[model samples]
Target: MGALDFISDYFSISTRRKKRKAMQTVDIKVKMDCDGCERRVKNAVSNLKGVKSVNVNRKQSRVTVSGYVDPNRVLNKVKSTGKRAEFWPYVPYNLVAYPYVAQAYDKRAPPGFVKNVVQALPSPNAPDEKLTTLFSDENPNACSIM
Candidate 1:
């Protein structure tokens, strides 16, 4: 029985099957000039296997796809419709520390949102540096130590 179990584990059929994709939501940025463009983009993504829903916001040029699908495949499908497309790169302005930094700020982004870029994130040492400055002798405003 032990030998049989070992052989069965070694030749497991489950290993040959493709792993199933987990549920996920993918947000894409696509410029749609009209209703036809919106419909085209929506239909292209909805027809994909495992896609549960698609929401298109033409005003923001954003398309949200929800299902068990790969993000790259979704982006490619949108691009196939003859529209320039890319993954959503912006995050809510309030979520970022330096949202107004040159690399993160964008005039084209919808209101209350800013581009997500490394340059816009606060440095890991920022808090420590602030503490050091607050206690430094050169800072007249710093509290005097006994």
Candidate 2:
């Protein structure tokens, strides 16, 4: 019986231990008006299991959490504190090719950041497009070879 039990445990898929959550950072945008708001938001997230650290920047209205926790769960935890919370939607301006595009620009975003949205114009200088345009009759600089 002991031998049979050992063999079953070795081959059974269900006997494997559950995998631990991976370390990750979750950034949330929460409007924190004052020190109290910051403390509340920080405490709410830090109390959750597996949270390693919490940072709140009231000026940017952002909370950064580092740990082995799900992002949605952290967002829900922030919302539970009666504050409107959402995932950070801004990316560095220099990272985007068309930073001034309608959907990507936001007046409310902090300096050097823009809303993360699909560019309105496809890249005009794409290699494939450049190759096509080089031989097309419409290009003024196209090779004169017929």
Candidate 3:
């Protein structure tokens, strides 16, 4: 075969492999109040073994985790953080949580609310401030789900 043909075939095989390896998405209902809390939720869930990405919408009170993973593990992971979490029972067929591309951040309290929060709070990751450290999953072997 020609060089171009060989390259095309090779790339197609690799692309298919990558697509097949893509992780599943599971959304979990989370309890989050503010930007800092949202950051903590994302940080915690993103550290999981099979987790690809985590998006937390505090205003909506939802956390969506996209990864080739199960809801139970994610639920357990969130609960470990002192927050109450469950697969959203509101969904029909008992869906864990409704999946969606996370939407806009609307801190739509009255005007000047967020600005006041910024002024009232310290800078992100301030040296003296303590941040929540997420726990490593109990099973280290599952991390290779890439």
Which candidate wins on lDDT? Answer: 1
Tens-place lDDT digits, model 3, residues 39-130: 87788788888777777877657788998767778888888878898775333212222122122112432222211111134454775432
> Candidate 2: TM-score?
0.77
| Per-model root-mean-square deviation over C-alphas | 6.5, 6.4, 21.1
Q: What is the clash count for each candidate, in the order shown?
A: 0, 0, 3
Per-candidate TM-scores read 0.74, 0.77, 0.45
Ranking by lDDT: 1, 2, 3
Where does the lowest 10-residue lDDT sum fall in candidate 1? Answer: 119-128
Rank ordering of all candidates by TM-score, starting from the highest:
2, 1, 3
List where candidate 1 sits over 4 angstroms from the true fold: 1-16, 120-146
Report the error of model 2 at residue 108, Å: 0.7
Top-scoring candidate (TM-score): 2
Given candidate 1, what's the lDDT at residue 83? 97
Error of 2 at 97 (Å): 0.6
> Global CA lDDT of candidate 2, please?
0.91
Window of ten residues with lowest summed lDDT in model 2: 137-146
lDDT per prediction? 0.92, 0.91, 0.62
Candidate 2 vs candidate 3, lDDT winner: 2
